[model samples]
Target: MKTKPLYLNDCYIHQFQADITEIGDDFIVLNETYFYSRGGGQPGDTGDIAGIVITDTKRDGDGKILHYFEGDCNLSSGQSVQCHIDWPRRYAHMRIHSASHIVEYFLFRHSDNQKFLSSFISGGKETSTYEVTAAITPEIVEKIQHDANAFIKGNHDILLYPDENNPDYRYCKIGDIVYPCGGTHPKNTSEIGEISIKVKGQAALGKQKIVTTLMP
Candidate 1:
């Protein structure tokens, strides 16, 4: 059975009730879920289901979200359960995830080259990073950092919508850049706070890793 991913539209939803559709040895699948599965460089959310603690979450082969507890859930397939997500943790992820995009938008606009070789990021409990591909230049880094911070301070609402003409594309339009992503994000750019970028100086010949992170 397919599970409905609620975080797609309402990233702030933390508590809900759902019926268990399938029960496995150590995991359970709900008909609907607010918990975010691991993807897009963001880690999966950990929370509680009823009284049972959820250890990890993953998406199955058929796109079903499986909430895995450390041990057996001991629940039936048709059982009803209450889900309580860790909002603080989820919100932090949303902020950092949005910060990454804002940073990328600045780089994409400022830099002369648009082909990014490779990038990576981690929005953990304490901190987050938005690693992008760019050359290690003092001027480039400074400009991107300044622009990203300005955009964040502008408090623009990050609009999340589908491509009406091209229905297959889901767009999260932030400032001038439109990203096709399904990850969680804050309602506005100000919620992402300040973004800082740094050139790692280690990448392909025409590429570099620009680390965009939160400061204070």
Candidate 2:
């Protein structure tokens, strides 16, 4: 199995020493990695692995994570290599991801008659969009956005716990609010900064497609 360092700590950006476990025609599998593979709606990390620009990262069906390089490298299996992540990009993702959770949390709380089924982050140049499952109106979207920012301004703490029994575990709590999540998030809500949401067309007859964006 491929070692996933990001799961242990989302903030980890540098791994000076890692062993190359396998290499393929277009990718290399590391014995350990800090790169966050594409999952949970969050984008995979972009950075350098053994001085080669890592263009993409993904996990295979067998759970083996692969790092694809932009250029050729003299790396080999069992060879020690250094890994470095683009901290600013990853941090931005963390902030936006946390904001998304807050938005979902309040949307559910405010719309007690409704429930949130899913959410995903769509990356862009200067901003990331979060598509959430909810039947929200424009006014309700605005209220939820405002309330989420209010919670962010309050600087509520965010925590992550890895359960061996339930490896895919996610739970967020803000005061009396509590919800389940499996994605990475910021340490505190304040780190999320300003955010906005645009209510898109309906996903179905009753479901709304809301796109939440982090303001620049």
lDDT values for all models: 0.76, 0.70
Q: What TM-score should be assigned to candidate 1?
A: 0.86
Q: Across residues 101-166, which tens digit of lDDT does each residue of candidate 1 receive?
A: 777777767775545544444543222222334454778779888888888898888877878898
In model 2, the clashing pairs are 170-181
Model 1 alpha-carbon miss at residue 65, Å: 0.8
193: Cα error in model 1, Å: 1.1
Q: How does each model score on TM-score?
A: 0.86, 0.82
Q: Model 2: which ten-residue window has the lowest total lDDT? A: 124-133
Report the lDDT of model 2 for residue 164: 50
Give me the candidate number with maximum TM-score. 1
The runs of at least 3 residues in candidate 2 whose Cα sits more than 4 Å from the true structure, single-residue gaps closed, are 112-118, 124-135, 168-177, 203-207
- Give the best candidate by lDDT: 1
